[model samples]
Every structure is written in structure tokens, then in C-alpha cells.
Target: MPDGTELIVTRSPPVNSNGVITLTNRHLPQLKWQESLLIARPVNQFRDFFPEVNNQNLTEIAIEIKETYNDYLKSARSLEDLKNRHPELREPYIEVTSAKSQRTIYLTRLDRFGTLESVFFSQDKQFPVDLQLVNNKIDREIPNSLLAVATLDLEGKSVEQPIGAIALSSVEEYNLKAGINM
Candidate 1:
């Protein structure tokens, strides 16, 4: 049973003949199903199509999910109640910054983008191999905290290390599935 708090599902803006966008109260079944029933599985499984926007502060989204989950828990009539009833949402927020610039060309290319991403490492400093060992530990021991895929190229100067690419998609995709198109 739904609690007293109403679940307000915002409808999408409809395009009119005159090219003006208009809002309506009509409910879209896709939106409702996606929002109310689609987030139960793990998100790391589908990481390719999602965007990586780490700067997006998800405090609002977190609060909303927390509230809804809290409400569901509170509304539970008993401990033996239905377990598979409500939606299971996942939160995976990934923030990635390249650790090193392979060469002057790579740095110059990155500079051309006009968006200076925050550096993950300190300036003019070298990270010990222990860091990589720790990452390997986390990847192997605590796989849930990270989803890493690394590769060693034929040339020793460059080894590819890609991490946290699927994290943000874990939440952003939920908004899309919910018809928010965020």
C-alpha cells in the first residue's frame, strides 16, 4: 500500500503544432513502470552508452531515493511482508580524471578541449607502484566499489587503465529510464 505522500510523476512536455512546448498531467505508463519498477538490477553491466558526469551533485536525487526507500520501509506492515515488492534502485556515481598525460602531444590535445579537468594526481610527482597494487586489491577483493578494466600495450610507455566509467551511469540511467531525460 502506498503511503500518504503522493508520488508525483512529472509528465513530459508535448510539442504543439505551433512549435510551443506544453506540459500535461496525463500519465505515461512507460515513465511509471520505469520509475516504479526498473532499478532493481546492477548498473555496471551496461556502461558503454552512459555519460560520465562526475560534477553533477546528486544530493537531490539521493535525498529523494532515501526518502522513498525510507517510506517503503516504514510502510512495511511487518517483517514477513513481501520482499520483492518495491523497486531496487542503484546509485553509482563515477568521477574520472586522467592520472597522467602520455606525452606533450596528449597534454596539448587535452588543452584544446577548453575544459580543464581536475587532475587526479599531484604535480610533478610520481606515484609508487603500491597505488596500482592497492587498486588491484580493491578490484579483486572489493569488486563492488570499482569496475576497472586495465590493459598493457605492447609498448611499455603506455598502459591503459580505465576506471569508474560505469559509476555515474548507475544513477543517470535511472533518470532516463524514468523518463526524466536528464
Candidate 2:
């Protein structure tokens, strides 16, 4: 995004065309899926591949996501019901992001070209521990919140104190999965 903000890029078919992943209605199994299916918050049209502007008012980022099909609602929060209604929206997308509570993140990366990715095993061969294995609804509330992040040298030791938690959401959940329920 030119505004130096983050975007929640969501796509219905979840196409990984070239290096870009999309959650748009452009490519669908059925054309009608564009109507009732692939419902999302719809990212602001200003966002681009990279940040080119220094936007200080970076708050309330409504990231696009694949939600349910409530005609009156902009983005549906029910996955199970959406599944029962639109069974054609298949594959790991609906399966991966489905959650009773909390949230499910399929994967995360740090490269601009998708040239390299983090791996759970050493054989995959990657750099930097950019992936955070957090599974809590409270911590996941903030759109682009930072958590206990630290860097290390080859020996793998904390190079600095992890950054403090930034809660953009004033609606604090002091007890929501407060005890590592994941």
C-alpha cells in the first residue's frame, strides 16, 4: 500500500498467480459465485504491492477476507454455516481459515517476490523465524499487531528484548484465551 499500511488480502478461489495471491472474484469455479460467494470487506482501492507513502493515520485496517454470505452484511463471520450453504467454495482455504473461535492463519512470509519461505523443518531451508505460532483470540484481535519479537545471531539468542504488545483494538479481552488455550 502506498499509504504505508497493511492489507488483509483475501480471495475466494485463493489463486497464487505468479507471485500474487488474491481473494477476488475474478477467477471462480462458477460465475455466479461472484454474487453470493467470495464475500469480503473489500480492501481500499489505494493499496498496492508496496508502501510508498508515510501514512501516520494507520488504524482500523479492514483487511479483505473470505467471510459468509449474509445478504445484509458486508463480511460474514460464520464459516461453518457458509460452508453448508455454499459447498462449491472448496479446498484448503475454507478448511484452513475455518475457526470456531480465535483465528487460523495458513502461512506468513517476508519476501516481496515469494522467492523464499519459512519452514517448520530444517530440510525446507529458509531464513529468519518470521512465523509466530500464536493461537489466541485476544492476541489476534489487532489487525497488524506486533508481539514478542526478537532477533538472533547464528547461535540463536535474543539480540534484544522483544517488542511490547500493541493493541489497536480498545475493546480489550483481558481473559479471552489468556492462558495459552491454543
The sequence of per-residue lDDT tens digits that candidate 2 reaches over residues 108-162 is 2222112233222223443333323233233344343433232334456544322
Give the best candidate by TM-score: 2
TM-score of each: 0.16, 0.17
Q: Could you tell me the lDDT of residue 82 within candidate 1?
A: 23
- lDDT of model 2 at position 34: 36
Please provide, for model 1 over 1-182, each residue's C-alpha lDDT reduced to its tens digit, 9 standing for 90 to 100: 26778776699555554432222323333354334543444446655655564544664675688788767766664422422321121222222333452211001112122223524322345432211211223233332322333333435665544332223233333321211111
Model 2 pairs in collision: 2-53, 10-23, 11-23
Name the regions of candidate 1 deviating beyond 4 angstroms. 1-120, 123-138, 145-156, 162-165, 168-182
